[model samples]
Target chain A: MAVLLLADVNDGALATDAVAKALSAVKGLGEVHILVAGTSAAAAAEAAKLDGAAKVLHADDAAYDHGMAEATAALIVSLAGGYSHIAAAATAFSKNVLPRAAALLDVMVISDVTAVVDADTFERPIYAGNAIQTVKSSDAKKVLTVRTASFNAAATSGSAAVEKVSATADASLSKWVEDKVAASDRPELTSAGIVVSGGRGVGSQSDFALIEKLADKLGAAVGASRAAVDSGYAPNDWQVGQTGKVVAPTLYVAVGISGAIQHLAGMKDSKVIVAINKDEEAPIFQVADYGLVADLFNAVPEMIEKL
Target chain B: MKVLVPVKRVIDYNVKVRVKADGSGVDLANVKMSMNPFDEIAVEEAIRLKEKGIATEVVVVSIGVKQAQETLRTALAMGADRAILIEATADVHTDIEPLAVAKLLAGVVKEEAPGLVLCGKQAIDNDMNATGQMLSALLGWSQATFASELAIEGDTAKVTREVDGGLQTIAVKMPAIVTVDLRLNEPRYASLPNIMKAKAKPLAAKTPADYGVDVAPRLSVVKTVEPAGRKAGVKVGSIDELIAKLKDEAGVI
Candidate 1:
């Protein structure tokens, strides 16, 4: 029951949270090996060795620079013969690529898994976290993408052998172009302990700044509902909903956000939820542990001043 | 170029799905059903392509129960030229599998030979998100998933997809599959006249048997249960009171 984890890297560094969580996922199954596919795998390789993993496999190739699903899926499919379970952090990258590998292997992918009950049994959220489903895979090989927020990070120290694997061909299905990611010094919305989110009721981008100020005061991350992101009040990455990142922070505050079912799907698991809105029936108040009905413009400033 | 859009009938996005007490599955009995939100975006994109003259014809295909015909008609009302409904039964192993859906779609793709295949990123029901990718691999065609923008040129389709990091643009060869992200396009409302006209559009019915693909449950659901819920807490009178509660009672601060 060997496991292969597709490592998520950023700016030449390996994303450790997902890998560590994934390491904990396949804990009792067997030895875990991580795949680092990128242009410069040096930093990621060095970091993977300390992931408490059995081995680190690096495929240094320019074709994988953008993580175009076609090439990355092919690379994993070719290497799929050795591993009993193939897993990745359920990020945009893994969500885009793991299914491709599963298709090539003629198996169905188990997505956003929260717990590994056994070698073949897994627990995952369905119907937007309102329901929990446990599945048993009859397929010989299990292709899975795990929700990183649900698991603890594996310890950071260990010595594992590093192996250089050959790169696969470019699928040429698509080419990478320019990017416009949000650049902020604030904590990342998904992993932040405290998340402060805004919605369309924020009025405009200028109003969204108040949400950010309160987040800064609380040392929290800024999140936005789908409407806020679509209304251009926040960056696309700031969206927290069914289509966006699923976060289970310690504290979640909704400012001017009338919770849509999709938006609630992403953050309902938070330890504590507080809603501040003028609309008492905004649906967000239904799940909020503490509800404050007031205009955000008035409420946010007061909260910021208090913090 | 002819376009192929595959749509799915899923639990309406607005509906609050309830897990059955018996643990069979999510209670779908008498629940409102609608087009998967992402698939609606795909349908809208294909219609836009047709309206722009980049595509000459748009064919909408769905694989599900007989009720799925309504989903196809909605696509046709939006502007698809025709529809195909692959008949499915209620049984999991004997009737529908995600792979079976892809295989049947491959048959349609072979027969229609559309230059572009558009579909949703995933269905809300199982959330497997693999059908389009599986179809692309089965056809040996290149693919672009989570596409937010699309532009068609000679023998190439340049697509911009939404990723966690940011938007990424890629060019896949013609005759490829593209899965739509939520932001791809806002679907238009079907006018009363268009809804009537969609009823007259050509709709063909087939089955997984026609595609010669095996239909069996690749994975089994062992148990289904309601997720743990947080109890409703007291409402705070003031901002200061909320802060005190957070620090003292909740201890999250």
Candidate 2:
């Protein structure tokens, strides 16, 4: 009947701009409903303020605090009867949750959709964004994971009514342990306005400071290529690639990074791309808006000094 | 305590993929195919579990074209105790959606009754990171997606997941499905002798009908095309020039 969207919550509020972008994705399909399934009511309240949503469904529960896929997916499936389309931002959160709900509903999920062609047709990147596939689903209900970068964020200018949802999703099969999330003063990689990334050229773990110094100079988030992460030059969370987090920031600076196709899939959509590397033949130069053929060790420090 | 791992045959990660000139799909003909990089990690993790005495056997399965047998053989060489190739499709282009694959795997899980199932978080070809989560749902079991670190203790598994912000650890009951991420562990290379030994290992060929699962296409491909390429811009000489371009020309700063 309506489109149900799972809200991405942070602490007690809507997480970043992802939900607003997801709202933009599900807006014209049907009656837009935002489902705030979390441990806090503040997130539901924030969802109610989103302009496009017709209503906010709040399912406040402790089991959802950790955002466990099992409980969250069960909650979505319990409310599946009232919606024709179920969607969420294609982050690690919803990626872990939505497909479970889709399988429970006996429907196929169109993961990381970049375009909504009508209600059933969607465009998604396949083969690490080297090829774009437009697919048409024949399922009764369409389950989608919206690639938020593909759409603009919906404005927050509405006072949609909030309804309470009483549902018990047993999460007895799983238990939340602990999170070792890096608590940084720097901007979050996915939501930052600018991102500075490093690669194997950044060299050892200690040498990643050059990339961080530049990121700090620009007040940007720090990111890394799969090469850097695999080499232990950076943490796994800092990876930016097809298998990693995707970002479409306004400014993306690649420091000593070779632009592998998988790496390009993550940040090729950036408005301004700056590549600082010694190797002129690196594929990153092809996509760079500003290419500097210089050693990043010297160039980054100099840039930091200039800034 | 057998650990089941599902591997997919995909275009090698090292190979640059090319979209078909006709724009129907990616050209798979004459392309180098290998076990998905992530699934190789899964197979390696399963074998590690057996080596650690946490699992008694490592069983690997691949659901795809007949060519996928090569992918399974690679897994067997990597140390899987046995292999199963479910020939789901004849055409290379007929990409069976995750829902169908999960259903078929769920059937295998019922028959094998492994203590755990480890799979790649997503396939390299489709980039659909849904199978493990879907399979967990179909089995009505717990799931830990994007797992980077996993440890089995008694009847539970403590998995450290690679989430957006950071690593989140969770403990799931046994007979769970764990979808692995990039940082899980380095996949080992199949040694020459092991590769030879793998050829003698028990390899079984099965069909979707054997599992009583319908392998039907739910999504129709409208078309596939190469993404718009970004052109190389003018190279700036100095830091000042780069800063000037960002502030004056681009205004992104």
Highest-DockQ candidate: 2
Residue A182 deviation, candidate 2, in Å?
A: 1.3
Ten consecutive residues with minimal summed lDDT in candidate 2 chain A? A7-16
Docking tier of model 2: it is high
Which candidate number has the best TM-score? 2
- Per-residue alpha-carbon lDDT of candidate 2 for residues A1-307, written as tens digits (9 for 90 to 100): 6999998875566784899899998898999999998778788888888888999999988888889989999999989898999999999999999999999999999999999989999999999999999999999999999998888888889899999999797979999998887789999888889999999998899999888988998999999999999899999889999988899999999998989988999999999999999999999999999999998888988899898
Residue-by-residue lDDT tens digits, candidate 2, B1-253? 9999999999998898999988889999988999999899999899888888889999999998999989988999999999999999999977888999999999999999999999999999999899999999999999999999999899899999998888899999987999999888899999999999999999899999999888888899999999988899989998899999999999998
Q: On residues B116-174, what C-alpha lDDT tens digit does candidate 1 reach at each position?
A: 99989988777767788888877878888988889988899889888876777788888
Query: Going through the candidates in order, what is the number of backbone clashes in each?
Result: 0, 0
Writing each residue's lDDT as its tens digit, candidate 1 over A1-307 gives: 7898898876566777667877788766778888888877575556565556888888888787777788889999989898999999898888878887888898888999989999899999877777889989999999999988787778877778778898866656677766666677888777789999999999999889999999999999999999999998987878897788888899999999998988988998888999998998888888999999888888899999987
Model 2, stretches more than 4 Å misplaced? none
Superposition error at B195 for model 1 (Å): 1.4
DockQ of candidate model 1: 0.71
- Candidate 2 TM-score, C-alpha based: 0.98
Which parts of model 1 are misplaced by more than 4 Å? B90-95
Highest lDDT, which number? 2
